[model samples]
Target: MTDDSSRAFVPGHVTGFFSVHEADDPEQAGSRGAGLTLSEGVTVEVEPAVETSMQLNDEPAAIEAVTRVLGDLGVEARVTATTDLPIGAGFGVSGAAALGTALAANRTFDCGRSENELVTIAHTAEVEAGTGLGDVVAQARGGVPIRLDPGAPEYGRMDGVPARSRVEYLTLGERSTEEVLAGNTDRLSEVGVDMLVRLVEKPTLPTLLASSRKFAREADLLTPGVEDVLEDVADEGGEAAMAMLGETIFALGNGLTRAGYDAEACEVHPTGATLEMD
Candidate 1:
């Protein structure tokens, strides 16, 4: 810990495609998908305090995922999370904050929890909060994660695309995930399952983006701006797709720039969430 406070970083994840699976148990509820872990994300700082408090981007807030972790650990602390990615824009900012909180709190209070335990805690917290499904697990593993099974880290299974490259994204606006998940998702799941199967067979970047575009079309979650940007990127010989549950589109490498859009770019994070060393 640094000066009685701890800090952690969690890469933001962009799920290309996913099929949700709910259960009575939060730990057993999650989604199966594949996505890239961007280097830009949320960084959380934790300090033991008399009463628990939280601030997001310098504003007072009660983030449910952060609160859930503190409550589950039976500790009172002040949490401050600053997000590099757009909030509620499918960059997995909430999940990043949740995972970062777990990592920082574990060090701040000396909870002595293992990596998997912390991940499970964050995953369960996200599911319980209705903010996300597989993002916590993807942020925990980094890279291009292929979620083969649905659940928390301990119960779920994942694989990777085994490669890395740049990612470009542009967020037109924020979108709430709860409404999307609460609505009927049978068709979404069906298309997602098929795309996942195809990805599992190929496990390449081209296949991932191709399958993701198909999934997004089948799920009917693309905005006009997103669709236009995708077409432009493809015309420039680059692959792109809409980020699930958000009006954001991400392209492989320099796709967005080549398409003449001013986009935020970053590489796929090589590592997952961890305590930031002083």
Candidate 2:
């Protein structure tokens, strides 16, 4: 019998990073950051087949993640992935796709791996590929997740906002996360650590957005386009912030349309990844 499984996960946007620390184990090394998972995300399908293959949503990191998971599980299958959000737009598409693939593949192969175990697999894949840092962990827990500690689910500590809020985002363009992360992060890390501490102390959506905006300016990550959009969004009485590692702007309200930008609206997803079998 061929087993088929499908899973859904939320996309996350990082507010800032505290530090990029290396652990005794490579998988445990990551950045402490604050992020939130939106309702929109990627869905993955896994089915037993003669050969193992992956069809990702134009994310090369997903190829490494799927291949690694299938190799570890000793299962051969065809993996298909799709997403509602743009890849590399700081929406955690790569992390979501990896996490969804891991969940669905575990069920499809009847591996009986725990959620934490699956999360670790996905996190390791993302880290190894340099595609993401805390996104997998944040997407795993959903909501406005704060990465108190870095690493996979087992080593990382996650907290979040208890309430859901409307989220609107406009994509200006894409940025290379690997390129950004590889640059000297001394200044960025300092500001990020401070912002993360403040956000954890309060843990609210407004505080998150405000802190994100501050981080963007302090870290010098903002572009002229993003600045223009933010100015227009403010004029329309909305609070907006740039998505980490991307040129996209995530706003708190629906005033983006009035600013001449098309906004995609969603709610803060309250839960983590989910799976289905057929």
Candidate 3:
């Protein structure tokens, strides 16, 4: 008989971040971003096995993270993961999957790794794969998390907004985070840092939405589809902003749905990933 462990985590929408790298200290290299965790998320199931195998909703990039953690523990397992959100649309699906997998596999194999260690593994995998930057850490500590300092949990700092509200989003299409990050991000990082500072000084839902939109414009990340949704949201007297690293438009209210966009509505997830055994 084999015991299975399952873990689920909410997806986050990064408003902005300043990506930094410390080659000598991988743990100190990451982004400082602010975003909220949505109710939609990824779930991973793991059980002991003779050899490691993974099924990740056809997400190839996630395999490395799972395999790396399992290999480090010298624990073979069969891992399966699923998610409700679209990948590469800035919903942080990859980060959620990686974090959830780490948590589930750890418990499934009775590995005594601490939470911070698991988070570091997942964060490093995301960074190396270019799938995400600070999503893993933010997802580890849910709500409207502000990655005040860069890097994995062990070497990073985080804060968040306590007020929760309904969040609505529309998936426009996919954008490759790797491609975007590879480009010159001087202006983007500068604007992101400014926005982060402003938001931290006054952490509120309205401030987050406003700063997110400001970041999009300053970073030149808005696409035609995203612009259209934002316009529609505005006409309806609501605010909307593009999710970082993707083409999705996340609104603060249900205005997008009323404006004829198929917006998915969910509350802000107030906590991090969770694991259960059966």
For model 3 the local lDDT of residue 237 reads 88
Give the TM-scores of the predictions, in the order they appear.
Answer: 0.98, 0.92, 0.92
TM-score of 1: 0.98
For model 2, residues 203-266, the per-residue Cα lDDT tens digits are: 8877887888888899899899998998998888787888887888887757677677878988
Best-fitting candidate, scored by lDDT: 1
Query: Which lDDT tens digits does candidate 1 get at residues 66-181?
Result: 89998999999999999878888999988888899899999888899999999999999999999999999999999999999988877899899999999999999989899999
List the candidate 3 regions with Cα displacement exceeding 4 Å.
6-23, 58-62
| 63-172 per-residue lDDT for model 3 (tens digits) | 56667667767778777778778877888877777788788877777788999998998888777766778888988888889888989886788989878888888887
Candidate 1 collision pairs = none
| lDDT accuracy of residue 168 in candidate 2 | 82
State the C-alpha lDDT per candidate: 0.91, 0.78, 0.78
The stretch of ten residues in a row with the least summed lDDT in candidate 3 is: 13-22
- Please say which candidate is ahead in lDDT: 1 or 3: 1
